[model samples]
Structures are given as structure tokens and as C-alpha cells.
Target: MAREQFDLIVFDWDGTLMDSTAHITRSIQAACQDLGLPVPADQAASYVIGLGLREALQMAAPTLDPADYPRLIERYRFHYFLKDQATELFAGVREMLQALRDDGYLLAVATGKSRVGLNRALDQTSLTSLFDGTRCADETFSKPHPAMLHELTRELGQGLARTVMIGDTTHDLQMARNAGTAAIGVTYGAHAASSLEALQPEFVAQNVAELSAWLREHA
Candidate 1:
């Protein structure tokens, strides 16, 4: 079915579409350990999943000096990429995206991932051509800020009122709110449903199946 209310469907990459929450959590912990900084608990590490790498690492390894940020970033990348090959899209994600595209929705990605990381993932997943546009944290403001959505909507020629941001973190929901757009949250990622509920998203999906159904019926 075609979408009536939303014209642009923007997605967050890590937890919303990709099954990389555990991998990301582990990688953050490992990066902190590599620099002898106190490792954040799983809850803390995962909580920063939708933020930009610099911001996420700063929160995850708060004890590190600013001068050592490059090293920390390098370590995070090293640990992250070691097993990034095993990361896969959540089940039904590809099909749902295809369905939305088939239904005339302008699909795009607004992620905290860097340009390099997102492009690599998109190529690896063979999903590059599926999107009409993309905005990366490195190229624009990170989540919880409206710049990414604002830029995406402008580039796609869509209005903020007719855009929806779907993601698995508070940052994502907050960004949608900041962008003056609607949001839908998925709990099968870094954050719990209770955590996401506070932001008042349009829908909260427990899994990709539920998300797909919601989008198909109501998006």
C-alpha cells in the first residue's frame, strides 16, 4: 500500500535496520579497555548507539584526554571492523524497505555512522541503490539534532511535516522531534521499549515484523 501521510521515510542504521547493537556495544567496551579507560557497562555503552562516534566514544570513555581522541577512535574502529563482516540487517528489513520504495515513499538514511562506515555497510548489504539520499554524522550534525533530517528533506524535496524518522534510540526520537517530524521507535535494538516510550513516538515496534506491519498499514 502507498503511504498517505509520510513522503520521506528516514531510517537509523545501527539498531533500527542493522543487527549491530551487540557488536557495537562490545566494540565500545573493547575500545575503552584498549586505552585503559574504565569500560562503560552494557547499558551505558548501548545507550550511546545512535550518537555520532565522537560523541558516543566521549560518553563511553569519559576518562580519556581530548588529545587521545584520535587514538581512541582508531581503537574503536579496529575493534568494530574486526567482526563487522558478520553484522547483518535485521530480518525483514530489506523486504520492508523494498516495499516502502515500491509504494512510492522516498527512502533515505539518516545515521550516526560516518560516511565511510555507512557506505561500506550499504555496499556490503547491497542496499546502496535502495535509498534516494543519505546523511552521515561525519558530514552533518549527529542524531538528536535536526540538521540531518533537515538536510535530507531539503535534498529530497520533502517537507518536514511529511517526513518520519524511524530508529531504536532516544537520540533518534529526539531528532525527529527537533526536526518537527514524526517518529517511530523499534525496541529490538539498543534501547528498551520503556526507554523509547518516553519520547512519544507514533509507533513502537518489538521486531522487524511488527515494524513492517505498522509501516505498511499506517505509514
Candidate 2:
């Protein structure tokens, strides 16, 4: 196969890089409990991992009143903060990102997290300098809208064809499709690899090591 030269690479947060899926799921559940609402099943909570927090909460608890959205979010933030400070990125993520950066690829993040949440994670990880750019769901449209990817490419002056989206959710792949860019799906995240394959990603990596290897040759 011919090597595809990509000028930019965008990553999704949460389950994509940070191993925060379980934390997010637990936070959502805790928030629901605090609101006296039915806690969403693990699968249900996991399903919304790549959506904006409002949307994720709504989807996970459809019966929740809009008036309660603020409280729900507050409760979520409470539980999230309790554990977020202890969270860490997935194994090999730092090494992979550093390798990609060393190879001269412009790295950016397009995540469903709010700007504050993303900034907090960046600061905690102290890996902020590794990324060239970033877009948060609260600052732009949520995943699968392509708005974040479009803005990132435009702002960075990278062509759609030469830009790649690497994520762990179908939302990420669909966003790449909407932005007319290539996508590489990572299986060890929120969504299943089977679901990712149905989206026809340019490549499907089972782990960070596999993803890094693929990028080493084709990115």
C-alpha cells in the first residue's frame, strides 16, 4: 500500500488517550444518584462518552428535566474532580505522542470535553506543550459534527485530505468523514472495534502500540 502523508493529526480525549472512560461512567452514575435519577447502565454511560456533557447526560438519562441540567452537571463535576486528579493517560500514550511529534506531525486535540476540563487535563498531564492546537466541545460543536476538525484544519492551514483523525469512538470517525479526512480508530477505548469497523476507518488499531506502529510507517 502507498504511504499516506498526513500533515496534521487530531486526537479525541477521554477513552482515546486518557484512560478515563470508567471514571466518566462512574461520575455520570454518581451524578444520576445525586439527582435521585436512575443510574445509567455501564453500556449506556459508555455509549455517550464522546458527546458533549449535556448531550451525554441527556442521552444517559432521557427523563432528566432540563431544569435539573445544571445540578446534574454540578454533581458530575463534583464526582469527576474527586477522581480526575488521580487519573492518568493510557500506557504508551505519552511515548506515542512524543514519537509522532518528533516525526514532525502537527498534533491537535478535538474532544467532547469542555475547555475547562480539557485545560485541566492538559495542565495535570503537563503534556500541553506537546500539542500544537486543541478544540473543546464547549467551545465548538460536539463530536461527529466535523466543526472542530474543520476549524482545526483551517486554523492550521492543513488540507482535509492530509489531515487524520485518531480516536476511540465512532463519533470521531464520523467527524473525520464529515470533514473529509482520514480516520484511524483505536479499539481499546469507549467504543468496540466492531462498531469502529462499521464506520470504515482508514485503519483500526487494537492498542496504542499498534497505533504508534501504524503511524510510524504511514502517518
Candidate 3:
């Protein structure tokens, strides 16, 4: 497909646009430690990508008492917000987005993160204006639900066939499939290359550089 053929390109936050895996894992581990629970390692934390915080927390610390979930979530959020000011956008992300935008692709974000969390990241990275629209977990059904993608397509006044979803997890790929749009998975974020490939994205890029190339060819 020509780069300008797609009317909209939806993005997943966290591991997709930013390198927040270590920051997120460290914050969650600290929260678990404070609650006297075992801290999941980096690889384990990566496995929780694309799910809402509540679900990801449960998966990360399944041994924790169910009643303590709220407290754990609060602690994790507090620690994460405190340290996330230092979060950085992934290499080549800004240039890639600019390239796509200059090529006339409408950009949007569909993330499992809450609005506050997503806004904070965008502000920190000076990317608040890059997106034409955002659909967050707090405002819509979380992935792998297709609500956000569907909403974005409607909001953009574009059909699903003319849109694409780019993300780093199976949840994102599945969401795209569920919404009947093309999906591209990237491997430099939270999930492994083989794992994302198993979801059968239309294309899988090993890193941001390759992802930009793929977008150029398929967008």
C-alpha cells in the first residue's frame, strides 16, 4: 500500500512509543516490595504489557491478597509518577512520527493506560501535539478489546480498512484483528519478537528503524 493510503495510524503507548519497561518494572517491583510481596523481574514484568494496570498487577503478583489490590495499585502509581518524569521516548520514534505526519498520515494513540498516565508521558516527552486523538483505558474498553480502535476510526471519519494499528504486544495485534484493521507489531518494547510474531501481525519489525521502514512500505 502507498504510505498516504491510510487515513489514520493508531499507536500503543508504553513499550511501543517509549522505553518505559525498566521504569515501569522498577516501580511495580518497589510497590510489591513495600507490600512484602515478591518482586517480579524485568522479563516477567514485560509479560504484563498491553493489559490494564489492574490486570497486569494481578498477573505480576498473583500471590498478593486480593483485598490488597487497591493499595498495591495506589503504591505503584505513586512511585511510577514520581520517577516517570525521567522517562525517554524510544530511539528514532520522534523522527519516525514526524516522517509519517509529514507524509500526511493522521496519528492517534490507543493505549491501555489511563488518560492521566498517557498525558503525563506525552507531556514529558513533548509529544502532546503529535497525536490527533487518544483513547485511553479509563475512557474506553482496554485491549485486547476493539472499542478504542473502533472509536478512533469513527472519530477520524475513516473506515477500518484505511487505518492501521502499530504496537508491541499481542493484545495490540489482537485488538487490530478484532477491529478488522491491519496491525504491525514491533519487537523492541515489552514483548519478544517471536511472541508478537505468533499473533500474526501483518508485519513485525525488530526495532524502531525497521518499523519506520515497514510503515513507509505499508502505511
Candidate 4:
């Protein structure tokens, strides 16, 4: 804790900072149901939480023809936004991000959400200015690919060695690895703790409180 190991801390959106995992899972399932495709189970649906909508749908409704993806995506968006107001950031997330920023660390987001979708969430939460930069799946390659992280670091003028990625899914962790950066996983989101642990993150926090504490002392 003597020296800050990271200059930039990038976070995944849906499950990491926001409490939208269940909502996303429900939307995916509902979309499949609307398309008469097999509805994915909660875990199955949640597993795709950190990928691009098209990639997620490809996994969640694999039986459906590729041409029908637009239909599924439309339905999924309908369901997700129906209760969008109900989705809130996990407790203490704002404070944690503010504290990090106040301490002079550059904060950014690398999310699976589309540019439009991410903009909506950030605007609704009034967190637009807190981020120094952001990269969405629609604007770059999806998770587990290095493009998003690479772009963010390059934009921020931060090196891979000076950046850390945080999230609640294996895709997030994998993306960090692919980008040659450190990762911290949170268990209170889409993926299970065991799954995140298998990715070998620097830390696994159970909640925002725990995550904040770890970052305070170690980031």
C-alpha cells in the first residue's frame, strides 16, 4: 500500500457498479420467451452479462437463427428498459468512485453495453462527469478482447502496467488479462465467486464495502 499500483481503474458496468444483473437476466429470458426460443435459466442468462448484446443473444438463444437476432435484441431492450428506473448502483459505489477520483486516480468504464445504453445509464445516475473515458461494446470489440481496454488506456495516456480492471464476471477478468492489466473481481454480481476465482484476480470482494476497503488500501 506504500505506492499506488494503478493510475487508472476501469470498471465493467452492469454487474460491477450497478445492481442490474437480475434485471438483465430476466430481460434475456423474456426476450427468448417472446421469440418462442428456449428461455435460459437464471444462471445461464447471467453468465452472458458482460458480453455484447449480439454475442450474449447468440449464447442465450443459440437455437434461434442468426437473422432473428435483431428481433431478440429489440425484445430484450424492451424488457430491460421497462424497469430501468428500478435499477440502481450498488450501495457505496458512487462514494467509492468519488473517493478514487478525489485521490487522483483516473477512472473509466469498459462495458458490454452499447454506446447508447451506457450513455443512458450514466446520464440517469448523474455519473457522466465522474468518468475520464469510456468504451462500449458497440464502439469497440466485445469483452475478452483487448481492444476496449487498449483504447481506454491509450486515450487516457496510461500504460497497461498502470491500469487495473474491476468487474463481476469472467469476461471482465479475461479482458483484463487479454489487455495485460490487473483485475479485481466482485462476487456480488453476475458470475459466481468460484468462476471469478478461476480467473485469478488480484482480489475478490463480496460487496461494494469490501471492494472499497480493498481499493482504499491496495489500489
TM-scores of all models?
Answer: 0.98, 0.97, 0.93, 0.98
Write out the backbone clash pairs for model 4.
none
lDDT of 3: 0.87
lDDT of 3 by residue, 29-56 (tens): 8889989999898888778877888888
Error of 1 at 5 (Å): 1.1
For 39-93, candidate 4 gives per-residue lDDT tens digits of: 8999999999999999999999989989989999999999999999899999999
* lDDT (tens digit, per residue) of candidate 2 on 1-219: 233689899999899899999999999999999989999989889989999999888888899889889899999999999978888899999999998888788999999999989998999998899999999989988888999999999999989999999999899999999989999999888899999999998899998889989898887
Q: Against the true structure, candidate 2 has what lDDT?
A: 0.91
TM-score of 3: 0.93
Residue clash pairs of candidate 2: none
Each model's Cα RMSD: 0.7, 1.7, 1.7, 1.0
Query: What local lDDT does model 4 show for residue 144?
Result: 90
Q: Residue 59 error for model 2, in Å?
A: 0.7
lDDT of 1 by residue, 1-219 (tens): 657789999999999899999999999999989889898999999999989999999888888899999999999999999999999999999999998889989999999999999999999999999999999999988889999999999998999999999999999999999999999999999998998999999999999999989888888
Off by over 4 Å in 1: none
- Worst lDDT 10-window in candidate 4: 1-10
10 residues in a row with least lDDT, candidate 3: 1-10
TM-score of 2: 0.97
Error of 4 at 54 (Å): 0.4
What lDDT score goes with residue 111 in model 4?
Answer: 95
Q: Between candidates 1 and 4, which one is better according to lDDT? A: 4
